[model samples]
Target: MSRQLLQEPVQDLLDALTKSEGPDILSTFTTSPKPLAHEHGLPQLAPFLGRSFHGQEGISAYFDLLSTYLQIENMKFEPEETWVIDESCMAIALRGTATFTWKETQHSWEETFAYRIKVAEDVSDDSEKNGSLKVCEYQIWADTGAAYLASLGNLDDMPE
Candidate 1:
C-alpha cells in the first residue's frame, strides 16, 4: 500500500462520523476488533462524562451518550495539514466546525482536531474477507467547558 492509499479509509470514516451514522462508522473497523479510544479533556466537575471507550460496544455506548446531551446539526472538516507516516499510519491536523444543539441551545464550535489513524494489517488486500482500515485512536482538543455549559442550559455562563 502506498502512502496515498492510506488517506481514503480515514476520510471515509470521518465522513461516516460527521453524518452521525453509527452503523456505517462501525463498518470500518478491523475484523479482530480493537477499541476505538476517545479521550475528552473535561473539568473535574463532569465525572459522568467518559474519558475513554473500548471496543465497538463501548464506542456505540459513547455515541449514545453523546446523542442524549446534544444533536449535531452539521459537521465539516478541513484538513489543514496531513502526514502519511507510513503505509499503515497517518496523522492529520484538521480544522472543523460543528453546529449542534445542546440542552435546546444551538451553538457552533470551530476548533482544530488532531487524529492519528492506523490501518489494519490486511488492508492492503482488496478482497472482501480482508479487514478494513479503522481509526485505532482519536483525540479531540476543544473547548469542553462551553459544551458542558451548553448541555446544562447554562449558556449565560459560557465564555464568549
Candidate 2:
C-alpha cells in the first residue's frame, strides 16, 4: 500500500536536516516572494534562542551558529504522535536523538530531543500538496540545560 500523507515528506525533511550543511535544511522550508517571510520563527533554547532569527537569512545564520558551535551525529526520528492542524494539514511531535558536541570545548553528549512541527500554509513554488512537506514553524525542545552548560565548557562537570 502507498505511504501516508505525512510519513514520507516528514521523513524527507528529517533526512535533509541531517545533512552536513544548512542549505538542505533551508530547502525544506516554504518559499516566499519577499524577505522576512518568516517574520517570527522557531527555536526556544539557549544558543539558538530568542527572536533574532526571523527570516531566511536569520534561519540560515541559525544553522551557521549550530555548525560553528555544535555537532550533531546519528540524527534520526522516533515518531511519538501526529495530529491534524486543519484539513489537508497536520503536525507531529517526535523524539530525535543525536550525539551533540560543543565544538568549543570538545564536549559531547547523547541528546534526546523533540520538535513541534507546523506545516507551512502557502508555498506556491514548493507546495506540500505535491507530497513534500513545507515547514512554516517548528519549536525545538532540546536539552537546553546541557547546551547551556556545554556553552560554558562544563556540561559534564555540572552538578546532577
- Candidate 2 lDDT tens digits, 71-105: 88888777524432332446655678899998888
RMSD of each: 4.0, 5.0
For model 2, the stretches where C-alpha displacement exceeds 4 angstroms are 1-3, 19-23, 33-45, 79-89, 125-132
Let me know the TM-score candidate 1 reaches against the reference structure. 0.72
Count clashing pairs, candidate 1. Answer: 1
TM-score versus the correct structure, for each prediction: 0.72, 0.72
Q: Which residue pairs in candidate 1 collide?
A: 35-55
For model 1, what is the C-alpha lDDT against the true structure?
0.59
What lDDT does each candidate get? 0.59, 0.61
lDDT of 1 by residue, 1-160 (tens): 6555666666777777776544486666543445465646763524325477666676667677677766675677766244535653444334556765674566444444455566554443447736655565555555576677666667666557
Decoy 2 TM-score against native: 0.72
